[model samples]
Target: MRLSIRSWVKRVTITGSILAISLVSIGCFYEQAARSRAIKDFPAPGKLVDIGGRQIHLNCQGRGTPLVVLEAGADTSGSALWQPVQEQVARFTRVCSYDRAGIMWSDPAKGQRNSHAIAEDLHKVLRAANEQPPYILAGASMGGPYVMTFTKYYRKEVAGMVLVDASHPDQTARLAQATGEPASNPIPMAFRALAAVAWTGLPRLVLPDAEVPELPSQTAKAITAYQPTSLAAAFAEAAVFEDSLREAGTFRTLGHLPLAVLSRGKPWSAFSEAERAAGGLTREQFNRAEAAWANMQAEEAGWSSNSTHQVLADSSHVMQLERPDAVIAAIRDVVVRATRANATP
Candidate 1:
């Protein structure tokens, strides 16, 4: 018993020491992140527009009849993240994309992050930037709802929509159900708890040296210059919006808008051994989740007077990024169809 007690004490001490070291390391990273973000020298591709009190980074490129707008996923990606598609499609139509509030160079706001609120902010940015009415809103993952809400709130302004692996409410329920096994575990509760702290505190250290890969080289450098402080601001704004998404019936209004959904053909749950070996599982898991989410969004889209679905059997959730040529062709086809259907008289 005495030996067991001694061993237990030693283990406790070791654990405590490891925890202390971890905390110190995190603190150091945060400091570096902050310092890196503070310097004011970086290049930006678009004009910086001031909306209310926030400075939003924006760019309008290409030229054509129908204006195309690309919206990104959650906190993990930004408008610049759609580089592959933009580079290709810009030749055919006017393509515009901007970082949402609290992302990259976009100024963080103290406003609510709900679908409606975000839609309103986007409208304000569009107007201020003079992008004008008649927008083809294309979104991936979480961005689907933002564009959907925009069309719902600003109907006349939206011409059509393209949802790339959109989110659905039922998926959340399915995920809850999936928690019965280790395979479908909803990110460990302990990890979530730790993540909450990291979200708030780590920004203090990481923003300084943090590197966002999605942004164009120049834009990334420009945005990274704002580090810790600006990054924290952006993170806070996202938290507010994420909280709103968690609320019941936050995006039900999307059902009444014109939309098209393109789902990935592959499912992570169905990944094979060869696929896992090829890194498909790592990239395919998120796409699989998004594909499931698209199905969830489909329910609401069906209720809408104007909505359609498309399955990209040969692509992943990141069809736009992974298969730019195919994505452009899909977008062009959708636009043509929407135009034809709308023009029928």
Candidate 2:
């Protein structure tokens, strides 16, 4: 007894749907198991202090005057991201790092994830943790804007700043103009997709270890454990990027504060052959775009009356990972200058 065509099609569709649902359920179960394991294996190494209703994770080390505060890049886990640089800075002055709300071990908060809100959160966490200032704030990538916003609102608290391949306020527009590409962010969508898939435990199977740096076993495990949460928080932040950029623009100057801008000196060779071809850009065009980016970074150094800009020729955008010494040195320079300034008069 052969089935009719309509019956056969309906049977096939139902079978496919059932199979898909079953696979998804299995993936979700595995994901939950992984999450449970992560929670058990990796606990927060720092203090989780209540800031308003939400808890923020604060990690402080070393002991000295003029504390150093490290801010991680967009979507990055804070203290873990600063591991290499923070350890060395701790050798001299007290240094601290923290996870912003909704990242890592930090509890989620209700608000727009713009620079202003982020900076406010940082200020609240620091005060709650009893860390005093004049602080030497170091920001990398998007973290640059948050630190700058902090300096703007709490001018008296900040002693100095280090911008490590920091994002310029005009970076999006400038890059768009330079590359002849429209300024837009696909990060939110990308992360949202990842979040959905991650819940299915697909990420555990497909996520590569290539991007994970050589860190302590515990740190590595923690990072892996928190990837999904970090991605979601990053998506929130990325979604408000334009607003964040506008907020950053309101900050006019650093007002004679000590500043160090570390720019990436490498070329734009990270673009694959396929990507470059897709963009319809010649090699020369790519080089020009990179030069424009470096120029914009140099301009960021000029925001401070007393500022110095250095191009890290041997490094990429993630200079902390590539050349931790350079970042440490910049922080040291600003700290020494800040110390000298404090002693004078």
Highest lDDT, which number? Answer: 2
- In terms of lDDT, model 2 sits at 0.85
TM-score of each: 0.68, 0.90
Model 2 per-residue lDDT tens digits across residues 216-287: 767877887777656667777888988887898889598789999999987566657886676567787677
In model 2, the number of clashes is 0
Cα misplacement distance, residue 288 of candidate 2 (Å): 1.9
Off by over 4 Å in 1: 1-41, 178-258, 267-294, 297-308, 341-345
Residue 41 displacement in candidate 2 (angstroms): 1.8
Worst 10 residues of 2 by lDDT: 206-215
What local lDDT does model 1 show for residue 72?
80
| Tens-digit lDDT track of model 1 for 19-101 | 98898777767656554454345434677788888877777788874788888876534666677788777888888888777
The per-model lDDT (C-alpha) reads 0.64, 0.85
How high a TM-score does candidate 1 get?
0.68
